[model samples]
Target: MAAPDPDPASAGDGPGPVALVIGSSAGYGLAATLVGLRTHRMRGLGIAFEAPETGRRTASAGWYRTARTAELAAGADFAFLRDDAFSDGVKEEAADLLAARFGKVDLLIYSIAAPRRTDPLTGEVHHSVIKPLGTDYRAKTLVFEDSAPRIGALHLPAADGAEREATVQVMGGADWQLWIDALQSRDLLADGFRTVALSYVGSDITAPVYRAGTIGAAKQHLEDTARALDARLGDAGHAHTVVAGAAVTQASTAIPSIALYTSILHRVTADRWQTPVDQAAALWSRLTGAAALGLDDQGRVRLDDWEMNPEVQAAVRTAWDRADTDSISTLADTDWFRDQVGRLYGWHVPGVDYETPAETTVPWPAPAGLGVTTHSS
Candidate 1:
């Protein structure tokens, strides 16, 4: 989508909207940051944990993406904190930076997806797992054989009680709540402040391993927390759980059944699929009164409307049923799926020369350590 021209009148003697985006290095978080800066003309801070290039290894894709974002945000009020968002130290540091720089935050985007979390309160660590709840689940999963995509049946054992609890602890809404409370404690939330947490509700085909799985349990807690947070914000602000559609992200590709499901879904919904940036643009339009807020029954902003269409789902179901090792290539769009994955890591992108030796160590524009604060003017 083309970015709208910034309106000088909107900056009336001050900055535009101020946003605090957690997990902003990649995926939805990165998309939201770009939309906020380019489309909405908002000034913001982004927080993420990423590693720089070592002796010979290249920097994380997120690092390069953030550097590109910094380049795009030239002459805009923005900064980035490369540290753990879950720690109290980083939270306090972020709060201080926001207070000093922007005075108030108009929006908060929480899209963190981590494998493990260390609780600051009790010093306990929790790890998340991707397993079903009740009986064992067996399904046709996609795998790469000799760099070629293939379909095979896979068995996944049920998650134990402790495993379920641990997953919830790691992926649940507790961290989001903590962030809100921290900002509230510092009186950093502006009037009409809004917050959103990204979520997904898959189709019945992958329910056993996804929506009805342990991660789903955590998402349930996340949605519940949003409701509670909305009530807590009352007249001062609002909170919502944005139900986004299936897409190939670094986090989504790691899930067991998502790759296969997304492949088939891509084939079924060819030419109509919405990337993360598209969804972020639509979301910005809704949030900024540029478009209608298409809310679902549970008060969620439904960006998955096309993905959940009856005919599209029916086609996906048919593809899933007929998918086998012999016909998988024709049944699913595995090539497109592989390309998306490659793009995530800064590879296979068009107009880029892979034969040329490029700079591997890219510096973050505004680098912040644990408790340091740096800003780009």
Candidate 2:
């Protein structure tokens, strides 16, 4: 279970420090940024991509989220950059900003999830795809339709070398390493700096489509990069991947054939359903608690411990074997999933009036005196 703060929302009376987060607009990044600022009293430097508002569509959710955060932050020092992390210029700009404002960054969080990536120097574009690697693998999927969760038709897809390569190019840890290198080269990393990137290793049920799929290939590279980073940091800095629980996120939904398993897993672990915020608290406590950066045998942080419990996995397996459209709604907590997905979009939250008219537009936290370039697409 995650140890939520005594008061999750406050002025962060605890000892305050400085940290930087990449992909801080939503999901793990947003939750981690909130925990750092509100729970642990950390000054924040956040980077995320938010498309500019136009005539038809509103600004992205991350923009509104950051605006809300800035409103709730009572005199906190958190600056956000709306830019691309894959760009070398952005990395350099962020490094310079850290050097000027924070002097040093004690914690670094990497949580970028993009469908495509372009090399900063080479201009090569890589697009990620999800498919079973070698043979056609069919798995049951779940869909939310008619106001209930029902098992979807079986999905079977096979991958080729091109698909696997594309997935790795886009999702791999190479850019993470580049960011770390950029900071280190500029002396922005503080002494004993701690850096973590979010990752996942799900149950065997979706291995053919997830754990052993192309995304899995990218995760493997991510872990490998962590090892190299650990070696580089030596004793002064600690860097590794934290294997988070299987939860609904924009990224998770992009993967194929995970819905049935996830909905069932949620019901099996309902007693401990961890949102990204919950995961963030657990990770922060583990990092600053009595323990000193403990790792599982795989040399990674194990936030997925509760999700990976043997009995829980057994129950999920049992559910998986018998689950179908007729039995899914009965077997899983689809309501919880519905609520969470709604909450992700800033709806169905308690204590907020949904009927009242409100303002959603807020200015991005561009650096003072730096005019931001807004592109509408």
TM-score for each model: 0.94, 0.92
Number of the top-ranking candidate, with lDDT as the measure: 1
Candidate 2 vs. truth: CA RMSD?
A: 2.9
The Cα local distance difference test for each model comes to 0.86, 0.79
**Model 2 alpha-carbon miss at residue 30, Å:** 1.2
* Residue-by-residue lDDT tens digits, candidate 1, 259-288: 889999998888999888889888887887
Task: For model 2, state the Cα shift of residue 315 in Å.
Answer: 0.4
Clashing pairs in 2: none
Backbone clashes counted, model 2: 0
lDDT of 2 by residue, 47-157 (tens): 888886676877777788877765555566778787888889888778777776678888899998898998886899998888778888787777877776777666667
Clashing residue pairs in all predictions, respectively, total 0, 0
